[model samples]
Target: MESDEIVRKFYDETVDDEWERLERHRVEFELTKRYLNRYIKPGDKVLDLGGGPGRYSLYLAELGCDVTLADLSEKNIEFALKKANEQGLAIKRLQVDARELSTIEDSQFDYVLCMGPMYHLKSEEDRAKTIRECLKKLKPNGIMFVAFISSYSFVWDYLIRNPELILDSERKSELNKIVDGKDFAGKGFSDNFYISPENVLPFFNQFDLEKLHLLNSESFLYLREPELLRQKPEVINAWLDLAEQVCEREDLLSMAEHIMYIGKKPIKT
Candidate 1:
């Protein structure tokens, strides 16, 4: 299947429930909120690129940010609009491709939250174009938040959860490709591009953006068995606290299932 079709179908079928089910998803959402609070003020204009179902957009709207959500999936936009109306939150929802935000004027937003596009844009050219477009949409010194699936974490996950894949010749080749920062799309997997921590900065260096921080969205949480990690609320909260403290630790960053790169567009002198 083509990348856009695969992504659209995946979200259309699963956007309603899959994200809320995982412990890691909850951690990612919490960390995202924490970072947004740190950088955004009330009344700021935020562009949430590829924001499925308005998860972050609704939260930002509630916090008084003028939020606009753009996504490729029509079903996602439908769900997002429904949720926004239900919550009595007013937010702009656009069903559009992240790479082609031509309708939005340049330098119009205070912050750009690109949490989903990087995961599926397989080619380096596509990724760079997407990032550049996002930066273009932000005002001078405006912040951009981009997220990626970490290659190391994916490999580690397979080793721990599905070791049989490592033994099978065909599956091993696909796994090796993923470890090499590529992905294979199929019935079980959406088209994705896994990125290594070491390569992330260099990948985005072409743009005139200042690096603010690189964080592991779910650091130590990835190491814990999901069933065990879900047992105690207090323990889980403490673990999340620990994740916040060590999110920027370089040694542990690549081990996270999701990695976030926060950068600011430099103000021209």
Candidate 2:
């Protein structure tokens, strides 16, 4: 219940901030959308499990997909509904936990977006349970997009946000603890689980799913200060094209902040 409380309290307090995260992080949003569009069709039924404020759900609905947004925070659901109404997009909402999606019928959704839950599931059992629940709701051969915060995200974050602490030898041990998915001492989101870059694909391979993709959401454009690139339309387009070209490159996967795994549930033989 502590994990649940952490997720609800954090997301509830930052509903508007969460909504703008995608808008501000242009590459993360655009590249993720590109990957989603590649597999999902116009009329697909999409379940955005743990979707905060329904950003993706609203986007999918606008593209003619039937979407249901679910999250642990009642506030997120309310905010998502409000946004959906303002956008004139009709998307269903549910206040549900990712590990327990029993209210949703099994094997109905064409796509399952289990993006946010994995980020906070600190235990292996909770992660696997949530994955099973997502798979249970997914139709055979359905596409599932799961997102992960890279184990080393804090390394980059520290260098950017806390430059002064780098020289502190004491900070090295702190970062090491964070790499193993523990909470950082003083900042950022709490109770988040970080995945090692090398283990991203292999972790999901244990399941009965075909690996479609394992790539960084921001790709090579991450620390390059993408916000500056956004000012030039042509440059942003070309950079996005380059990112999509190399996003799935295996060698470059570890340098990203957010990693996404695209998998397809295999139909029973």
Candidate 3:
């Protein structure tokens, strides 16, 4: 199936339940809240770019931040609105694509988040434009948190799980048809872009970078033997703490499944 189709199917089948499950997890939800709260102050205007089903938008609104949830899919917008209404949370939801978000006023948001776009946009120009758009919307020194998939996922999925695609790609890179340029064996879904650490630094360097952090939300601890990790929450927490401590080091961040970058827009001279 095509990448877009895969996303549509995945969201259609799982987004609702996934949102509820992820939201209910106190540890994960609190961690996400802490991350967002770092950039948000009370009454600040915020935008959730590519905000699927308004998870982060709702969270931000609960924290007294005014939030606009922008996404491309009408279904997602409807879902977000329904959830917001049911919860009595006020979030402005818009069906807008990240690559073309000009309808929003310039320098209007204190914080702009583009968490879902970097992994799906295949073209370099489109990806960079999304970043530029985020930068354009932020007030000077406004914080933006963006997420991307890492290159190390390829080794985990392809070499470890499915070797055929990796072996084929080894023979010829073009024939690889690897998903998002990461996992050769990631035939389950289509259209992924796995960015290397080398590419990520320069990509954010295009803006005035403030801080870069790695989040192993779906890798490392989560991917470890579930039973073992769950049996020893303290052990898991200890490992996670250690991971975060060293994640900024060059070798560790490259292996993360998702990286959260905290960047600031430069003030005009």
Q: What are the root-mean-square deviations of the candidates from the true structure over C-alphas?
A: 2.4, 2.4, 4.4
**Residue 266 C-alpha lDDT in model 3:** 69
- What lDDT score is found at residue 255 in candidate 1? 77
Clashes of 2: 0
Measured with C-alpha atoms, the lDDT of residue 200 in candidate 3 is: 71
Ranking by TM-score: 2, 1, 3
| Candidate 2 structure quality by residue, lDDT tens digits, 1-269 | 57679778999999999999888787888999999989888899999999998889988999999999999989989998998889888999888989898999999999999889988887878888998999999999898999988877878788877877767877776577644754332334767877778877667867888988889898888787556455687888888898899998877777788999989999998
Which is the winner by lDDT between candidate 1 and candidate 3?
Answer: 1
Question: Which structure is stronger by lDDT: 2 or 3?
Answer: 2
Q: Clashing residue pairs in candidate 2, if any?
A: none
All candidates: TM-score: 0.91, 0.93, 0.78
lDDT per residue, candidate 3, 1-269, as tens digits? 76556665565566677467554433434444557765578799999997777788887887788999987666777888888889888999777768887898899999998887776777778888888888889998788888776666555556445567645745335334333443222332346666765567677666665764545444344335344346576875666555445545665564565666667776777
Candidate 2 global lDDT: 0.85
